[model samples]
Every structure is written in structure tokens, then in C-alpha cells.
Target: MTNHWAHPTAIIDEGASIGEGTKVWHFSHISPKTIIGEQCSLGQNVYVASNVTIGNSVKIQNNVSVYEGVILEDFVFCGPSMVFTNVRTPRSAFPRNTSEDYRPTVVKRGASIGANATVVCGVTIGEWAFVAAGAVVNRDVPAYSLVAGVPAKGMGWVCECGSTLTFRDQKSVCHDCDREYERNQDIVRKTKDV
Candidate 1:
């Protein structure tokens, strides 16, 4: 018996490893050699390329395509229509189709990517970081930071519970969840979790 659930229209290829309790919704296609963790949700029309690794409890919304070389850690949220690219440059005359030509993009644990956001290849989106809608991310995003706009820039800091954090003396306490964080220059880390 199958532990996970896939819609009748969804296609899970052989050699794809999907954990128990995960759900693949309508018209979604999971390619071979992809590993999707437990309790994850793949929404409608989602396409997962080969060799991609998605951690537990990840939520991938509709119309998102997870290309090769993309690594989504546990609890990551991929908003609807969010884009992930593996190639740096493309031309009709020249094709870079192999895995060696693809650049790796890592979305750390608890990160949330907003709708219509485009994450370019070779970037690391940090843990608990929030990418606002329509942002074009080309660089590494720091942990617990909020980024927005085209070629996304750091707008503010956020708590692990997804609340905006107000830093005073490089430290802040989350008003919503009461989580505590400290910042050293550009780096932010959770000091207390309540």
C-alpha cells in the first residue's frame, strides 16, 4: 500500500522517493531521483525535476516548478507561481542541459518564498527568511531577514514565527510569538525560542 497520496492526474515517476503522509495534488509531476519528505504538499501543476531534494513539511503551491539543483529544507513554503532557475544564462543556439551546468540554489529551513518571486540560481536563502511577492532574488539572503522588490534587498528582520522584529541594540524580541533574536552586523540568530 502507498503511504503517500497522489491525485489521479498526478504523475510520480519511478525512482522518485516520496515520504509518508505527503500529498501530490492534481496534474503535478514528480521526476525520477527526486526525494520529497514526509507531510509535504505539492499543489496543482507543480513540477519537480530530477535530483531535487525537498525536506519534511514543505508546502509547494500551485504552478511552481522545482528545477534541478534546488534544495528546499524542512518547513519551507513555496508560494504560488514562484520561480526557481538552474541556469545562469540561456540561449537558443547553445543549451546547458546537464546537471553539471546547473547552479545550486538552497532554501534553508522555515523560509517562505512569496508568490511570483523569482529566485536565480546559486543563491542561498537563509532560515526563516521571507521573500516578498514579485521579488527577483539574485544573491544570498540572510537568516530571519525579509527581502522584497526586484533584485531583492533586505527590508527588515523577521522572527522564526514569521513576525516582524524590531531590533534595539542589535537584539529584538518578537511581539507575536515572543521569540528572541540577536543580530551581529548582517547576521541574525535566534537566542531564545518560546
Candidate 2:
């Protein structure tokens, strides 16, 4: 038997793969073909669809539905009621033939998606990117970027420590952690410590 712990009300299919130390709370549904890594937490009413892949130490908050064709890497945080859509143009009359018809959405390592945010399909959220609450992300987000507002334009940079960055002459120093970053146009990457 798997070492993962789930509440009695949770429905975990026999074909699902849950790693050791993972905790799935009440009313969650883990579908077949899904693989969740170690130390992950699925809060109440969460739904992980078939074939979804989640890496280690991920935190999915309450009422979130992780649809098919989505991959979440290690250290990712998905906030409450966040939305993920697989189809770009979903029509009720013309149903999708299979899960392969769905577009892939990837949230990279150390990324955090805030509550009620919407991640559109086929978009790659770079490592350490932060999506603010209620934002609508329709495009790719760069690493160490902080995006907010409608359509989720890159507002500024964010440190790996999860603090907002202030740049001077395309060079930013994270006051909270003293990590340095170089910004070229819209792309930001950690360079060193200040």
C-alpha cells in the first residue's frame, strides 16, 4: 500500500500514483494515470485529472481543479480556486476526441500561481515566476517575473525569495535575500549575490 495519506472522503483511483508523505484532504479526487510526487498537499475539494503530473513539494489549495495536459514542477504553489484550461476554443457541440487534443500547460519549478488566477493552455510559466491573484495569463511568463492585472503583463521582477525587485540600470538586488539579477528587456535571471 502507498504511504500517502488521504482523507476518507477523498477519491483516489487505483491507477493513480501518489508518492510517500503526500497528504490529500477531504473531498479531493485524484484521477487515474496521474502522478503526484513526494510531500505534496492537496487541500479540500481539489481535483487532479487523468495523466496530470505534479512534482515534489507542491501545494495545491482548496477548490482547485488541475485539468489534463498540465505539468507542475517541484516547489510549485497553486492557490485556491485557480483555473487551468486545456482547450483554447472549447465548443459544446464539437467535443474533443481525446486528451491529446488538449493543449499542454506547464508551470515550472518554484513558480507560484495565486488564488483565482487563470492559466491558459499551451503556456509555459517559467521557473520562479509569480502570477498574482485573479490575473488572466494568456502567454508565456519569464523566470523571476511578477505579473498582475488583466492579461497578466509583466509588471516587474521578483526575487527567488518571493519579494518584489527594484532595478537600477537593468541591475536589481533583492533586498530581502541579497540575490542579484540582471534584466535584459523583459527577461530577468539571477546572476549572483550582492
TM-score result, candidate 2: 0.97
User: Per-residue lDDT of 84-156 in model 2, one digit per residue for the tens?
Assistant: 9999999999998588799999999999999999999999999999999999999999998899989999888
- The models' CA-based lDDT, in order, is 0.97, 0.95
**Cα error, candidate 2, residue 8 (Å):** 0.5
lDDT of 2 at 84: 98
Q: Name every residue pair that clashes in candidate 1.
A: none
Off by over 4 Å in 2: none
- All candidates' TM-scores? 0.99, 0.97
**What digit string (tens of lDDT, one per residue) describes model 1 on residues 22-117?**
999999999999999999999999999999999999999999999999999999999999999999997779999999999999999999999999
Q: Report the poorest 10 consecutive residues by lDDT, candidate 1.
A: 90-99
- Tell me the spans in candidate 1 whose CA falls farther than 4 Å from its real position: none
Q: Which candidate number maximizes TM-score?
A: 1
